[model samples]
Target: MKHSSAKEVEVRVKRTFLARKKPTNSLIDGQVKISIRFHQLKVRFKQLSVELNLFNNQSSDDRHIRCQRIGTRLHIFILIGSSIILALYSSLTQEIHHETILNPSETQYTTLAQVLGDCVVCPCSTFSVSHETFISIKPIYHHICSGDFVSSAWINFLLRSQFIDFVLYSDYHQQQQQQQQQQQQQQQQQQQQPQQQQQRQQQQQQKPPPPQQQRQQQPQQQRQQKPRQQQQQRRRQQQRQQKPPPQQQQPQQHQQQKQHQQQQVTTTTTTAQSVASAFWSFDNNALELYNSGLDATLSGSPIYTTSFAGYGAAISFTRSSTQYVYITPKVLPFNSRSFTIEAWIYPVSLSSSNDYGIFGQCQATSSNLCLYFIARNNKLLCGFYNNDIQGGTIITMSTWHHVACIYDLTTMTQQVWLDGSLDGSHSASAYNGLWGNTAIGATFQLGSASTFNGYIDNVRFEARAKNSTEILNDATLHVYYSFDGGSLTDNGPNGINATAYGSLSTTTGRVNQALQFSSGPYISYSYTPFYFLGISGSSFTIALWAKPTGSYAQQTILLVEQPSSWCVHYLVMTSTGQLVANCWIGSNIATNGPILSLNTWTHIAYTYSTTNGIRLYINGNQYSTTGSFTFSGSGVPMRFVLGGDRVVRQYM
Candidate 1:
């Protein structure tokens, strides 16, 4: 039993040992796995240490050295990229700064430094410039630049005492007046004679037929009478049949007729006096319109007719009639060494045998000693006593022509101008007054020498000779507007001004600068002082250049309104793009002209007269009238509205 017990114990111990040994083997496997993991971790740490050596120490192994080289290359690439990016950013900043400094207003640019051989770079401020700085200019011009010829005194002397003579009356007009008065007086005498005869007859009948004759008649009446009543009735019937009946007129009608005749006479006389006085312009001293001359008297039978310019009247003379304008000699200083004579003439007929005179001043004794402007051989001839300067251009008949003769004593030159051009020029000797004095106080008259037949107008005489520019200006210029001065200023003889309203800008134009209209812009001008534009005047011309942006129902380009009438005249653009000129008299009178294209410049002109009606021109060519119209308005134009009307707002 003891031996068995011992054996069992040993077995148990072996079993226990075996179990412990099995567990120890499993633990050893786990230890090996942990060692392998630790080994792998150590290798990774070594690799990290190698990467750190790029900034620290060198490597020896070839593979380690290759790894180091790759790492070093990546580091160098990153440094190069960062440097390039920084350089690019700095360059971009500099360029942006440079561009910002350069773009701004002229006054805002200020120079800090500059090189003599290169353009100076400037910096600009963002502030706005003042309006005065933009408009004002400081000129570096000297006063000496303006020569003495432009002096006020010199200009005044050149244009002083200018005169425009209108020959409007003659003896025929006066004789007609006198004949009308005589006829009126004769009619009055005839009317009074009949009335006086009727009054005498009535008095004779009312005086009881004289008492002696009445008594004898009564005895005869009693012898023939059947009864008193029957005898009276027979006598009354015989008296009515024997006496002549008197012509009768109602008393109220006669008084009214007499009053009407008196009113007619007063009206005629007042009109005649007013017309005569209108031609006479006087100063404070009652001096003539021309400071250098006096009033002239009409002679013969010159009549007033339509003028060459078609605006006013001219003097017409017949070939056989002794019609002329007589000026008191010595009133005009024709004795001046330098003088200019100019006139517009229309010759009707020229005589081959005689010279027709436009103006003549002859000596009291000798007709040869004359300073006469005459038409000889169908050409202008200016005579200074013995010397005569003849024009080259032939004088055409019927048509209007401008003739001027100038005597410049300073240059000893004589010039003849036709139609504002120099027709002839000649050297002349100075004239010595005849009989040791001026040949004044003699026969001095226009159209007096020999015979003159035709029309004459705007006869002018200047103490100084005019230049070619002046002559051309007189012939061609009326009013001119150049909108380049930033304002609507007139560069013409008449210094008219215009006012602008609303959004009116300027742009490139057919001329230097053109007016641009937007947001209901317009220009206005008064017509008070313009006589040619008077509403009572029958002739007028309007010209304008326009560029339309769009068409509208009714766009008023020009509007002439009166205080009495709302719109006396208007030039409008219709929805159909046609230009229409309308005038209101008792009714509407309108003329439709050419169509206006959008966004294009066009020139338009309209002329009106009672005789010619309405004439519209487009771009220098006459357009076919779409409608014919006439104007008989008598209201005075108050103002001219351009680009719009008083109510309707039209943009252009």
Candidate 2:
């Protein structure tokens, strides 16, 4: 009997897979029948391999040895002996696994079943987090002969359709929902602890546990059980002193449990204590500088990050050594009167000589302006300066607390709000207008004060005295410029027209088309009403994208000048290619900036908040300080101009 050639086998496989796929009973029906067919297939595969090898002019013994190796390569374990070759085919149970990608809709599940052909797909299990059912798709190699083109084609189709995008949308949504629910439950649990503690305290107060009686009874009981207790203690000591003494593992585990329980108790107390703070109480419109809350948005500008919420499970990062978050100054509303800073914290330890800081934007320079938290006297002391406005509130270690510090410049008072209630408040001279007016060039830092072993989240800084509900309300954006329009028209509601000056140079913008300058063309804006750009306010942020083809040295980007009064170069690449942000307030130059590279399109922002001095940022990162100088803003209304000092013939 003559067996088929490799070409004939290939052709048969192709025809069977392509044409007979939908035909019922194409494969053998019963298990007994299929087993017989599989054995016949194995014998045929050996015959074809041997014939193919011999056709290639290999010796008979060499072909036999090579065929055995080939069978192993083909994933078929075949033991070749002298009399016969025992070809072991993979059984159905061994080859097919009950696994799944996801429990898709009924229609999709049915579609997958139809598409997989002989490759069986079946539901197996579900994830605990999402409770999403998964389906397993066995690799097609188990069903097809090795080196078969039919299997290769089917594999490609499965790869593209089944797993390329690999998104189980419903499963992901369910996971998020589950996570949020769990977080809510945890918050609720944290809040209830304080109440439980209070109840326990009340019960103790009512009973007034007879200390004298208990002490007397304890001595009597100890006398009665002294021998037995001493014997047990002696046995334990003996065990410890034995040769190759084993350390009791149970003590370590018990210690850990005790630590965990202490943490839970601390968190509960913190949450319970904060039930009545001004923040998380009212809803209104206030400038929210930074917020990690999903329900809240930042006030003025949109922050872009590839790691949207990589900090923790969401936007909060789990505190660890070598981990800290430095928020860009552009996103902060640092210096303000009647402002509130709020954050959720989980501290690890509190018994250090040095104070542990939670959130701070402090200038170490002479201005001495900062807003931050420090662990002092084993309590959370929110201070503006040198524990100036400290609300002496007890802050235990290993706990989560919703902490807020509010300063009202008018009242010249500082209030520390913990968990939702008023922890304490102190009236300090630093809460006056002068303290609020100080510039803070300090970095907006979370977990940056020291080796802060804690997790912080929902760090919202409101520019006004905001109750909790008011903090919830989103801030309205006043003006926004896309520079997308062909014309120099403001994209915001207020039409701030910008006309090109002498030597109007136009080049492709950083994003699209930008106002260019080869011959140093400048832009002159139409003066709006005073206070249009805030008549006199240090709490302002100026950001722009600049691509310097040539040198912007000595030339200007935007100058807020009252002629000889305050010729402030808002944003300028210096003569040395360094970005210089300075206001020449009547020759008392207050410039604090960093060196910038030329030719590269850099997003530079200069923010001047009284609390956080003039902060310079390049591409979303705070560069090193260029040293400090006092900045006194002139109350005079300054004209905003681009390019040179004048709107014409003024640039290099």
Best by TM-score: 1
lDDT per residue for candidate 1 within 182-217, as digits (tens), equals 999999999999899999999988876778898989
TM-score of 2: 0.26
With a 3 Å backbone cut-off (N, CA, C), the pairs that clash in candidate 1 are none
Tens digits of lDDT, candidate 2, 486-576 = 3666553223456667655445666765555544566665542222132333355677777665544566777776566445666666677
Candidate 2 stretches greater than 4 Å from native: 1-478, 503-505, 528-537, 563-565, 584-586, 590-594, 626-630, 644-652
> Model 1, stretches more than 4 Å misplaced?
1-288, 363-369, 432-448, 477-652
| Model 1, residue 545: C-alpha shift (Å) | 5.5
Model 1 poorest ten-residue lDDT run: 272-281
C-alpha lDDT of residue 184 in model 2 = 100
